[model samples]
Target: MTASESMATDRPDDLPLPPGPNSYPVVGNTLGFLRDPFAFYDSLDDYGDVVSYSVAGEEFCTLLHPDYVEQVLVTEESKFGKSDFVQDAGERFVGNGLFASEGEFWRRQRTLIQPAFYRERIESYTEPMVEFAADAANSWIDGETVRIDEVMKRLTLRILSKALFDLDIRNQQSAIRDAVNAINEKGDAGSVDAFLPDWVPTATNRQFRRATDQFDDVIGTLIEKRRGDPPGDDFLSILLHATDERGEGMSDKTLRDEMATFLFAGHETTALALTYCWYLLATNPGVRGKLNDELDSVLDGDTPTMADLRDLKYTDKVVTEALRLYPPAYVVFRQTKEDVNVGGYRIPAGTSLTFPQFLIHTDDRWYDDPDEFRPERWTPEFENSLPDYAYFPFGGGPRHCIGMRFANAEIRIVLATIARRIEFDRVAGGDLDLRMGTTLEPTDPIEMTVVKR
Candidate 1:
């Protein structure tokens, strides 16, 4: 039956809720989910596509099917908004920037910020990305062990700072890195601190406050410096010069919020993607050989340029496959603005909906040997055969990640440039124990030995 027909036949009030595991009083499934989120979410697949669950007394319906993902993110998008918890949590961290704001405010902010990500503008970032990657790769001594995650984070942050703000932030890298880590730790879904009230006088709360303050200080100083100087061809300059039809531009506060959002979201997500890509390559010799062959043929020891991106086909697929296996933004949360029917289940208004890329991307129904790392499977024919949402490493729809293009370019350029200069061999860690934080993070640092190519 059609979705609308199903809804017509069974009003939300009359229909029974979707089947799911039973919940305990008060805490609901909070403890179980926190124990091991991957296993918990995977177990729900047996209950059906639309499974009802609760956490801390809040109701949620997880949509496992790609069709339902489309319904929430695309076609019926207006009927859903960012979930309440997300809005609240995001606002506390990044303020009412694009990631948190909604309605006309969000629309206006997006319109103002969109120009910075235009094709020509993003292409301009290629030089910094390649330069930073090459520098990082050259600095590594052969046979020296390094934390791959930290290396990627530092490299991506340098690229981001130069490309986005036209500033040298190496001096402040530690402060910014600490701040980001503190915030993520407090925001981790599995952490008890995540559920506590912000006003509470706990160590997590204190650390969170300190982190936000430190971040604000760093961003505030840079924005102030930019305002005093002549405009440059960077994102900060774009935001500073961006005026509305009424001839007004973003206020200092607004700029800080947006800057925080981009800096935090842009750098962190791409870093994780590159880190995971490296881990996968280290573990899979065949994939690494193929990637190296493509890099050798296309780049041949030269820094990658925007033009070379067209020929970096295998490199692109390797990144795509890595994202599929370990999407940084593991789960997206949305709330129903009105009662909605999905997968023959009637969901009431105000119910939270989860679109888990981590779970859906690995579902064997859409991907053969879904647990395996096979970049070769990303042929055009294979991609065309799957549902659109089945492979959305970046979330889909109008509200999809604004930096999707920027991040894609950065990941490819950095991966190609670094692979041309060096190779990584896993030293100790075999598999990642991922933590579902603001972004998917490895519970421990991913250590690898760098070998010059």
Candidate 2:
């Protein structure tokens, strides 16, 4: 008999799944999962690397080890697909865009849009990133308290607009921002929506529908306007003209869906990342001092350009380390396509897979003094020594985030520009706690005072 068959036969059918928390009849672990999903996942670390649980009759398994994560994300990606719950929730906001689409459609869209983020294309946006960041910094009252989270959100939105669309929608910024926030706020907090039907037209549902329409109208108008205008180097222009191997261009709806996906996905994660970065810098003066020293030597207090990015090594390490601790997208969801064995555990088809980046990133096995903020630990030698899946702030495998390079460039440039021109001090007391939503963000306002240099 084959070893695979032998192992499978030896494992009892009713041996009970990997150890997990006991659940109330029928509802399963729904209450525990909803109370605090991140904390619940963290608690599973003590259970074992592979822990199983069921919610409302649905089965799930959380993979903690990097090797197991790699099996699901990279080596065995074909055996799985994006979770249906996540895809359904995402489609409510992003439509059938790349964020929600699967199979051949996703592959084709990814191919057509890939060129917009090429090295040359991304490098072209550096000047605007620095300019917008400087404009934001200059607008702040030096001695007064500024809501750094809002500041980063507005700055990133502007940068994504200028960098990707090459147009200004400042007049519509507030409305668009509100619409996005409403959709995110109403999403089944922490856990995916299983109990509530979106069609019920509750106040939040009506608001979500109205907000989605407003966002769609704005994006649709921009698409029409670009059709008649002279060809430009913006991302919109690239998407408009792109042709697949069969020379077929995307339809208007497809264009709108992808644009919305980029606008939504592009800004929020980066904004939260920058927000957390500032919080870290404020609390850790030594790391901030080293960062400022690098900036001073690199640019001599001038605006940074694409050429300066290579010289900003420590700046890169700081951003990398921040992402390690507080990845904006804390959890990734996938569902099995067929029965599979992950690390000797048999999982049936349609089982939900949760890969917690927040947990894997802080595993003491990979990082020494994991809780401590140490940028210097991310040296070339140390980074090379780690496994690929061990540090995936942007995710792994073929379906990883397409704009990783673009986001990194924007974060480094913006962080350097601001850090060079201003210093920040922590104003809020007590340990800063995280609030889970569409992305992981601080529960309380991260109030900080900016000291202009």
Candidate 3:
């Protein structure tokens, strides 16, 4: 149905939208929502805590209360399904892999894939993570203010590729990086604009198709390559040869989708998180100095080890707080599979849900001083006191990111590796902007003097 058609009707059950600003008919606030989602959300506070609005002509309700998130994410998995918008747009690349798959397929694949990201296996990737990061660091010339975000993207992409595949990758074979990156930049934005199909031969759609195809080819090759001679177990090798209890292997389409998801899930978000960490460090020197002290005390010229996660408390705090400020998956989109009560509102069946972690994390209600950049909020005792769903960088409930362990470990190693040698003093004068995408990224280039600390 056209957005105009969708918005024109007030469902018999429709309650006046949970109290937020009205948007234009059809288009709604979709363009504005896409422009600066955080601000678009924050501005909604003029009305109330929970707000309902439409975007891209689809009805959505935002849950600002963390308690509500706990209910949505943890207590009621059945009530919500990963939104169709995501399932549809994601299908273009990730296929019916766990991330895009719903119902039994999602359940089955998740169980099979869950073990690969366990503590033991993720720990094994630490050394490779440090090695790749250290090697990436060596090329860092003194007195240069490199774009740390770009550096981070390159770092995690390499880590996910080599560590997951053990240097033996699948269908994504060679073009993996570019293909995945292209999709990251273009695939899912405005996916629900029924008036505009992404497959149209428009230049933007052509670009998206080109990128998605490259990504698909790469994942396809990796699957086929590994299936031929499955040896030396890694995530891909295991998946390449994984079969259901009935002895049937996944369809080629399924494997390609999953491989793309892993590639996307494994790296891009981590890079953004690390990028935020650097920005936070650049802006707050006091926190930076303390972090350096932790690094120096923990390791005597050796790379950060997994065991360091316990002692490098401040480093852990930095990463955690950065996630609070700019979560990798900025928003968790869920749609009601069936209507149920939430935050005292009767969310009807088929209503799309917008649970913005960025908004929830920053809401003044839960945080003492939400605007300030303070890592101490993540102190051992303090962190434990918070509700399980209050701080959801990796999200919560069954769908919490599987790669959390690996990402945390890799980000820490990369953070410490870079922090130990380079001092990233903020560019000192520029208005920074956050470009909202599949992940949030700093639109401003941080030009800092990189001196050997």
Candidate 4:
């Protein structure tokens, strides 16, 4: 037999999966965790770094340790491939776009779209991002209680709708939010709905179906409008008019999928990141004060210009450290297509591997006082030695976030705009219970009293 088979059969009779805590005959940790995922993970050590858990007979190993994560995310990424959850979700909404595709199809899409994120193209969006942020911040009620989470959510929504698509989702906001709300509400309702491969008449299924349709409608209209009258400047017009060196262009359906991919994937992740950023800043007075000082000294209470973002050094570090503490997309999964050796464990191909970024970000093994939100950790000196795969707030390798440059500029500018204008008092009962979904979140909505600075 081959070496890969040797490891799979290496399971001794007494070793139940040989990696994680022992299961209770068949149930695993299913009933034990409808809540408190952090505690669930903390208790998994009884089984070790690689362990098996069967959720309704679909068993996948939960991975621990940073070394194995690197193998999955960096070295053997192409083979491992994104799991079905993303594909199923994408196909249901946007058809077979980049996020929904793999192999040559996904690769071609990536190459075609890469220029849209070129430094010059991204730099152009900075003005719009700052403008939207300024309008949102102006409506904040000074010294009055504000749902900071809602404000940031709107800010990201506007940025995604207007700036990214150059069209407003505000018109379709109700349809979109309702669908996302249901998706979240039915939390962990099993991966069964995804496996159906077709929609059903169930209320939850209906909601998702309607939301995706509405999203497609919005994207479809935008694509058509841009195709007719190209703006020659914005993203939509660029995508509509883009031609290959050979004069080839994307199909109409392909254009729709790409736009949907950006719309669906980009907005929520950014909202979660901003929410956590505000919470961290509210709790840590010293960090908040220091950041405010940086904003005041550099931005001087003006809306951060595209040029100002270049000079806003500390703000980048702050957002970087915040992402480390609370990465928007907490876990990345890849299913091994062929047998692979990883972090000293040899396993047969088809093994599902998880790289829990949340664990790595908080673990002391990689960082000094990992829990502490020290923006200085990303200093020029320290940043040099930091591992490439270790601090990926936007992920890394070929599938890294496309709009990372845009996101960094957007977040820093918005944070500075809000920071220099107002201060937050943390809610006495502010509870940040992380919900493990598309993005982790504070279980309690963030309510804070904002005072004009």
Candidate 5:
């Protein structure tokens, strides 16, 4: 039966929603949501695993349990799709790219683009990721404080541009970064004005539009130029020639969306992961020592290769643990396509359901001390003992982030390359605010002093 037909109900009122806070009329829980959406969702654990809440007038249920998450994102995925709110907000910047698209369109795009991120192709990016990270490390002066976030962002952007598109966006980096920041702020759940209509033409909205247009102009030109040139090895070249089973390649507009998607997804989250990784390392000296030990033993003072990275087990654990605490994409939202009972709550069709990685990763049931940065916790025994959905930093199911493998490799390469060459410590007394934006970014500049080792 079809999704709607299966969900057809006789007494819709009989379905009971999970318990939650009493919301005010009209505004609902807008105030609480505006105060802090991530915290608001966290508070729902006090009510129940599946609890109802509202933002503006719309009803949303937050799912905290891993079992519930499994059902929503994996087992019964066909009965759910990307949240309308996410699409509405994400499209402002990413357009109908993989991050925003749904249904058959998303599937087709995934098919065409999946090859660009394959293990073999992603392995090729290791050299550039290492080179860029090394360049950033070399540029830093000993004993001089620098904003680590800015450093990572620049390194990641340079790597992404060269490795993915084979284009140098150094000149356009500031404008592109600003555009991404604007979209992130506007799209954030904590932004009270996030629900504002698109036609309103607010200042933030105008900036968002301008940024996207600027990105489009740049990407459009790249596409037009690449269309006539001989195919190269970068993702753009692969995309230029990529054809489906029907033997048709992506159109110019589709190519633009995918390029924008890569620009945002490729650079943004990895930058945050590297930033947080450095923060974790600086704060935990013992962990840093262990990471360095593994690097030294494995590399013997040389740069890491793709094959050598496998033996850098402790380094991988560091990346995994940091992602657990500060997942770049902290939450995944889905809209139910049909009536479904999950965790004993009957969720109606068209309801928004959230699976928050931040909450799941921190749950004490699966973790010994969830807040602690312990790379050793990621061993095979622990991984085997835990639930799959309990630690999904890269999301889960078929719709999980396609670049996860690529990202894993990139983060490891960058970390190993920089760590072997320099010693950096987080400056004392700088505010470490974990900003909730399109991706989880630092609210305050993460200042650190770098010294050549």
Candidate 6:
């Protein structure tokens, strides 16, 4: 049925399921989705805003319209819960941390964790953000090729480790990086390995287990060391001392989970954002020129401080545009907790729903030349004219990413700081072949030659 026709019906019982592609007998749409998720999701827009499909007998829906996205993420969020895939996969690595937990426990954890990302607390991280960006920029020899993705991941991880844990984890970065890679590979949404039970002995599972073990060893030692010492001012210290209305704090296990979540989600998303921003800049010289002009005029070769952010308008726009094109958290998944009507169709309880930011951000209805890298399109007037969920990279509602403010500030600062000293020239033939992972990742390394500006 058409969306309008479905919506005209008042009774949930009278609504029909959203239209979707025909599924195979047993595998459903699994092979098609796994073959190329981006293409698969893009094809759904042809069906309708709300489209239904299945994978291995599990029913799923994709909400393409921004209003439907708002209903699921904001207005009627409580009626939905974190999808089992997210909870099950995430818990294996991050434990019952904010990203995986549900119900009252999730609320309490959010309340306790909220203080770490307060404006004042985030502002304190600016020094480290700029310092790390500067360090990474200086270390790159002019005309030398670097893998932009790896560079960003390391730089962001160092910044986050210092800001969140109050430790310089340069020595431990290799192990942490390996663990994150292994976890992401195993947790990838379209991977067959993702659906397999953890108890099953497989090569991927073995690597995943070893990686998690190494991760636990590193984080466990840090937590234990911090517990015996006097409290300090980093995120770890804040979480350690933070008490609820009941005057209780998190246990060691909870602390480990929170640490793991912050370390992975906090750093990885920002890194990918920056990586894509650099890639976009290298390819679109006009935007890169405008960005360089802003950095030059604002900071004038000096490292950017938190105070310099307001004047870095174009730099911010470049970051915004990059995020629009390559949102690291490409899609968000949620499961229905009760029967609900969305866009005139009934979504039954326990159905998996996907809201693809990548799809919505590039829809022709919301953007002109949606695939083009045009930072100029992000004027304040233009921004105000769009639907709210159309541009949400960090998500929305009560469960919006706690690290949003922190990430925005960091992206602008790092982009400004590094751009002031260096420029990247894209290596010929280095195009990003996108892959859907725990976050959006390039199938091949993103290589670029560094040049002193």
In what order do the candidates fall by TM-score, top score first? Answer: 6, 1, 5, 2, 3, 4
List where candidate 2 sits over 4 angstroms from the true fold: 1-16, 191-195
lDDT of model 3, residue 110: 85
Whole-model alpha-carbon lDDT for candidate 6:
0.87
lDDT of 3: 0.74
Q: What lDDT tens digits, residue by residue, belong to model 6 across residues 1-453?
A: 554344443666677877999899899999998887778887998888989999756789999888888878897799899999677777778999888888999999999989888888888999889888888888889999999998899889999999888887766687678788888888776688877777778898898889899989988898888887777779899998989998999999999999988988988899999999999999998888888888888887688888889888888888899999999999989999887898888888899999999999999998999999888999989999998889989988998999999999998988888888889999997467888888988888899999998
Give Cα-based local distance difference scores for all models: 0.87, 0.83, 0.74, 0.70, 0.83, 0.87
- Model 4 stretches with alpha carbons more than 4 Å out: 1-18, 24-29, 32-36, 169-172, 182-201
Model 6 bad stretches (over 4 Å): 1-9
Q: Candidates' TM-scores?
A: 0.97, 0.94, 0.90, 0.89, 0.95, 0.97
Local accuracy of candidate 5 as per-residue lDDT tens digits, 1-453: 322233344444466777899899888888988887667776888987778878876779888878778877887789898988878777767778888888888888899888888888888888888777777777788899999888888888888888767966666686667766777768776675578766578888888778788877877888898998888879989999999888999899888888888888888899999999999999999998888788888999888889988898889889999999999998898998887777656888888888889888999988998999899888899999997789888888989989998889999999999998787888886656775777887778889988777
Cα RMSD (Å) between model 5 and the true structure?
A: 3.5
Query: How high is the lDDT of residue 6 in model 6?
Result: 44
Q: Write the per-residue lDDT of candidate 4 for residues 1-453, one digit (tens) a residue.
A: 322233343333323333654556666655444335567766765666665554433445666665556656666577678766455544666578766678987887888887888888767777767777777767777778878777777778777767556766644577556545555443333334433434667666787777778766766776776777845766667777777767888888988778767766677778878888888888888988888889989977578877887788888888989899999878776776765554335545555566678886776766899888898888777777765556776766787788888788778877887788878887687357776765676667788887788
**How accurate locally is residue 413 in candidate 6, as Cα lDDT from 0 to 100?**
88
Q: How many residue pairs clash in each candidate at the backbone level? A: 0, 0, 11, 4, 0, 0
Positional deviation of residue 88's Cα in model 2 after best superposition, in angstroms: 1.0
